[model samples]
Target: MKIVIIGSGNVSYHLAKAFQQNNIPVSQIFGRNESDLKFISDQLQIPFSTSKLNDADLYLICVSDGSVGEVSRLITKENCLVAHTSGSLPKEILAGNYRKASFYPLQTFSKSKNLDYKEIPFFVESEGEEDLELLKNIALKISKKVMVSTYEKRKYIHLTAVFACNFVNHLYARAKEISDSQEIPFDYFLPLIKETTQKIEILEPKLAQTGPAIRNDERVLKAHEELITDQEQLKIYKIMNESIKKMYEL
Candidate 1:
């Protein structure tokens, strides 16, 4: 199956490489950004890239939510099987009376690091049986953990992912900033963070949760307040602590 990726952002870059690494064919990559188009083209050794979306067996739209619909309308072929990599965007956006589907990989991407797609959950959907099977086959070739998700189920999963991954990563970023301001090495927290994440694999996060929030220790809370100067950070800490306490009935 000859695959093509639209957009050379983090999602597109990672997915394209995964496709290539798994021995799945990647024919071309499209990106509006000249640098992005060139980057993926050079890296994948499939230099037949364009700013416009040419024809392909599968068009994996990895553009931003703001641009996906407009871009899809402009680029897709009448008979091409189009799919978007977005989790939050509705499948109907890609459904234009064509063989449309979704190939959403639930993982973050960065240029420096290669992703292990085998471990990431792939939420795929299609309108027709043939198209569904094709998408499923393609997904299963790259990953062993492929799941068929309806539009509603995908929406729910995407929502939970935002809370679990994106929101939590944002918290980690804020923690790093706070640590930097205090002249503390952010790497010092990495081992504890890794353990926290790993513990949840064996136990529920609620069961694994620790610290003053779970303990409802007022003294520790007071100490934390002195460390953060930003009112918003302080508010977030207080709200999260309160929510944690309320969740476990601490």
Candidate 2:
């Protein structure tokens, strides 16, 4: 199957590489040079690169939310089967309201990491029965984890990812800053972070939760807050602590 990728960013690059690694044909990779097209081309060594969309068996548009409709229109309408690797986009946005599906991968991607698709859950949707099966089969070539997901479920999962991964990363960044200011190595938190994530896999998050939040020791919470001079960190601490307390029924 000849695949064409639209918007050569993180998702595009990774998907292209994963396909090629599995010996699946990626006919072309398209992107706006106004963004990160060339960089992806250089990394993936994708033979065909174009700012304008072209023809392929499967069109996987990985462009940003606002640009999805605009970029998708640039592709040939005859492909009959198309999918977007977006969590928040509605499935019907493409396929000319025909056979479209969401080929969303529910994992945070960084350009530097060598991703193993087999571990990442692929969320798929298709406009018709045939298209759904086609996407699922294609997805299985690279990933063992696949889910036939709805638009609303994908959106909720995206938001959950924001809170679980993105927000946690920001918290770590803040922790690093506070540690740096105190001449403590930010690396000290790495094990703690890893352990916290591991605990969630083995147990419920609320049960795994640590820190002053769960203790309900008002004095300890106050003392920690005083040390966090930054208003943002203070606010984060307060909100998170409140959440933890509520979860624990404190």
1-250, model 1: which lDDT tens digit per residue?
A: 5667888798988888888887888888877787887888788887555545556777889999888888777654677788998888777787455677888888878888976788888888888889888888888878888889888888889889889988999899889889999899999999998998999999988788888988888999999999789887898899999899899987
lDDT of 2 by residue, 38-68 (tens): 7776666775566456667788888888888
Error of 1 at 177 (Å): 2.0
The whole-model lDDT of each prediction reads 0.83, 0.81
Q: Which pairs in model 1 have colliding backbones?
A: none
Where does candidate 2 clash, by residue pair? none
Sliding window of 10 residues with minimal summed lDDT for model 1: 46-55
Identify the runs in model 1 with alpha carbons over 4 angstroms from their true place: 95-97
TM-score of each: 0.94, 0.94
* Cα RMSD (angstroms) for every candidate in the order listed: 1.6, 1.7
